[model samples]
Target: MQELKIERLVKRYPGRDQVIAVNHVDVEVQAGEMLVLLGPSGCGKTTLLRCVAGLEDAQEGRILLEGQPVFDASSGMNQPTHLRDIGMVFQNYSLWPHMTVQANVEYPLRARGAKADDRARRAAEVLEVVQCAHLSDRIPAMLSGGQQQRIALARALAPRPKVMLLDEPLSNLDALLRVELRAHLRAIHRELGFTGIYVTHDQIEAFNLGTRVAVMNAGRIEQLGSASQVYERPATEYVARFLGIRNSLAIDPQGGWHAGPTPLAGDLGRLDQHQGPMQLYVRPPSVSVLPADAPAPGPGQIVLSGARVKDVLYAGGEIDFVVELGQATLYATMRVGGAAPRASDPVRIQFASSDALLYRNGQLIDG
Candidate 1:
C-alpha cells in the first residue's frame, strides 16, 4: 500500500510582497485513496496539487510518497516531476492533434526508453482500461471531446503511476459528459488503486469523486472530511454559503439570535457561550413548510407564522417555494406530489433548533 504525506507545505508566487498559493498545509492520503482538493477558482487548490506532483517548487515543506522523501525544503532536496513517478491529467485534454490515440497513450513508455512491443502492450492495456480501445487508431481530431479526454487519461495511466493528479479533468466537457467521465474516473481509481489528488471547483464533482475532501480557501484547508461531513457540517460560514445555504440570520452577543423581524423566544442553548455578532445557517431541506390547514408541531419545534409564498419554482423532483418570513425571504423544498403553495399563498414554516447551525468568528459554533 502507498501513502502520501505532506507536512507544513507552502508554495508562493513572486510578487510585490509574495502571493502564497499553499500555506502550511498538512494532510495525508492513504493507499487506494482519492483525496480531493476542492475550492473556488484562485483558492490555490491546483497550486497545492502541482507542488505535490513536483511541477511547482515549494518554498517550504516536506512531502513523502510511500515513506520516501520526494521533497524536503529543510534538506534542500526537490525531485523533478518525471522522477517523482506521478501521473497528471490537465483541465484540457492535452492530446497531440497530429498523433493517433495509441501513440499518445504510448508516449510516456517511449520517453522512458521502453521497447516498441512493451509500449504497444502497455498502451493497449490502458486504452482498454479507459474504454477507448475502439478509438485507439483515430487521431485526436477524429474523436469526440469525451474520447480525447479518455485517451489523455489513458496516457496518464499507461505508465501505471502510483500517484495520480487530475486538475479539473472534466471541466472542459459538457455537463452530461462531465458526469459521465466523473463516474468513469471513480471506477478507474477504484480498480487501479492509485493514491490520487483530484482538483476541481465544482462541488458535485468534489463530493462524487473524493474519498475524502480537503476544502481549500486562500491557500489553507478550511475543512477536511467525508462528503457528508463537509456538506452537512461545514466548518465555517464561508463553506455554508459556498454550499448554497442561504437561511442565515445574524446573532447578537447576548445569546440572542436575530431572525429578521422575527423574535428569538426559543432556547439559545450552545449559542449563548459565543461572542458578538454571529451567523445562523439553515439548509432549505431542513425547513418544513406546513399547509394552511396542517396542525402545529410538537414542543421544541420552531414555528414561524405570517409567511406568504413569494414564488414557486418546480425543480424536477422537488418544488422550491420562496416564502417571505417577516422581512426575510427563505426557500423550502417540497417533494413532488405534496401540497405546494404558489405565489401570494399564505404558508407556515417550521424547523427544529437542532437543524439551525450557528457560526461565530466565521467558524461553526453550534448546529
Candidate 2:
C-alpha cells in the first residue's frame, strides 16, 4: 500500500527575483519503506520534506498521507502540522533542555491527551527500545549528543506516527557516532517497520539507510532508484559526478576520445552504433595509474599513455594519484604499494571498458 504520495508539487519563494524551490515533483513511498532524499544544499529536498509535514504550504500540489489528503492547493485545504500526525527528527536534536528524558519522550503523547498511565508506559517502552532507559531521569543538558538524539528519536517513536520525517538527524554528530547511530536507526526501522522519509546530503548515509534513494538537483529529482542502481549506473552526468565518477572524457564520431583539447589514446571498442559526440565516465577506483613503462593492460581494457602524476595524496591505506594528461586532470585511487609513483613521475592510466559508462546528451547509452 502507498503510505505517502506527492503529486505535481511546486513551491516558489518571493524575492527580488522569484525562486522555485520545488518544481512539479512527484513521489510515492510504499508502506514500511524508507525513502531517502539525497542531494546537495539548496536543492529543495528540505523544502519538500517540510511541505509533507505541513510545515510549509506549497503553492501547487496535493499531498496524501495514508490515503488522506493533508495538503491540496487546488481545493485550498492545507492541514496544520500538528493535525497531520507526523513524527519529525531534526539535526539539532530539538530536545527540551529543562525536561527529563522521560518527560521529553512523553510530551507528544501528553499533547494528544493520552492517559497518564498510557503515556508513562509508552515512554518507558520507547526509552528502553532506544537503550536510554537508564538515563530517563537525566535532562537533555546532562546527556551526550548521541544520547540526546536517541531520546529525540524515542520521543518521535512514542507517538507511533503514521509517517516519520527525519531532516539530517545524524548530520551534527561526530563521524564515529554517526556510523554507530546509523546502524541503530536501520535496525530500529527494520524491527518496527515504520514508513519514513530521510533527508541527507551525505551519500554514504543515504546508501546505508535508504531502501530507495531519490537524487535531487536544482529543485528536481535527477534520478531515483536502489542504492546499487544509483551508485553503479547513474542516469545523468550530474548524478554521475555526485556519485564520484570524476574521470569524464569526450568521444567523437570516429571513435576518438579527448579530454578538452588534449587527445586521449584508447580504442573504446564497440562504439559503431553510438552516433555523434558522447561522453565516457569512469570512477577513480576503476582507473589504474601505473608507471609509463608498464606493460599494456589485458584485453577489454583501454589504456592511455603520456600522462604525468602531478600530485599524490596519502590516504592511509590508499593513495590518490592526481594525473595530468595534456590539459585534463584525472584522479586514480589505488592501494599503497611499493610501486607507487611519486609526483612529477611519468604514468599511464587504464580501465576496463565494462567499467566505463557512455552517455550522449546527458543520458546513459545502452550497450
Candidate 3:
C-alpha cells in the first residue's frame, strides 16, 4: 500500500529573488519503505519533506497519508502539522534539555491525551527498540550525542506515527558516530517496519538507509531508483556528478570522444544508433592508467594513449592519479603498494566501454 503520496507539488517564495522550492514533484512512498530524498543544500528536498509534514503550505499539490488527504491545494484543505500524525527527527536531536529521556520519549503520546501509564509503556517499548532504554533516567545534557539522537528517534517512534520524517538527523554527529548511528537507524527501521522519508545530502547515508533514493536538483527530482541503480547507472549528468562519477567527456556526432583537444579511443559499435552530440560519463574507479608502452587493449575497451600523469595522491587504501589528456584532466585510482607513478610520467588511460554512461540532451541513452 502507498503510505504517502505527493502529487504535482509546487512551492515558491514570493519576492524579487523568488525561488521555486519544489516544482511539480510527484512521489509515492510504499508502506514500510524508507524513501530517501538525496540532494545537496538548496535542492528543495527539505522543503518537500516540510510540505509533507504540513510545515510548509505549497501553492499547488495534494499530499495524502495512507489514502487520506492531508493537504489539497485545489480544495483549499490544509491539515495542520500536529494533525498530520508525522514524527520528525531533526538534525539537532531536538530533545528537551531539562526533561528526562523517559519524559522526552513519552511527550508526544502525552500530548495526544494518552493515559500516563500508556505513555510510559509506549516510551519504554520504543526506547528498547532504539537501544536507549538504559538512558531513560538521564536528562538530554547527560547523554552523549549518539545517545541523545537515539532518544530522539525513540521519542519519534513512541507515538507509532503513520509516517516518520527525518531531516538529516545524523548530520550533527561526528563521522564515526554518524556511521555507528546509521547502522542503528537501519536496524531499527528493519525491526519496526515504519514508513519513512529521510532527507540527507550524504550519498553513503542515502545508499545505506533508503529502499529507494530520489536524487533532487534545483527544486526537482533528477533521478529516482534503487541505490545500485542510481550509483551504477545515473539517469542524468547532475546525478552522475553528484554520485561521484566525475569523468564527463564529450562524444562528437562521428562517435569520437574527447575531454579537451585530445581524442580518446572507445568502441563505437553502440553509438551507431545515437545521433548528434552525446556526453559520456564514467567513474574514477572505472578508469585505469597504465605505462604508455603497455600492450594494446582487447576489444570493447576504451584506451587513451599518450596521457601524462599530472599528479598522484595517496588516499587511504587507494592512490589517486590525476592524468592529463591534452587540456582536460581525468582522475583514476588504483590500489596502493604498487610501484607509484610519478608526475610527468607518460601513461595511457583505459576503461571498459561497457562501463561508460552515455547521455544525449541531458538524458541517458538506453543501452
Best by lDDT: 2
Considering only N, C-alpha and C atoms within 3 Å, which residue pairs clash in candidate 1?
none
TM-score of each: 0.90, 0.97, 0.96
Q: Which stretches of candidate 2 lie over 4 Å from their true place?
A: 255-267
Error of 1 at 138 (Å): 0.8
Number of clashes found in candidate 3? 0
Which window of ten consecutive residues has the lowest lDDT sum in model 2? 254-263
lDDT of candidate 3 at residue 104, scale 0 to 100: 94
lDDT of each: 0.85, 0.90, 0.89
Question: Which has the higher TM-score value, candidate number 1 or candidate number 2?
Answer: 2
What's the lDDT of the predicted structure labeled candidate 2? 0.90
lDDT of 2 by residue, 282-335 (tens): 899888999999876788787878899999999989999999987778999998
Q: Quick one: best TM-score, which candidate?
A: 2
Candidate 3 is scored at a TM of 0.96
lDDT tens digits, residues 160-212, model 3? 99899999999999999999999999999998899999999999999999999
Candidate 1 regions off by >4 Å? Answer: 251-258, 264-278, 291-294, 298-300, 336-339
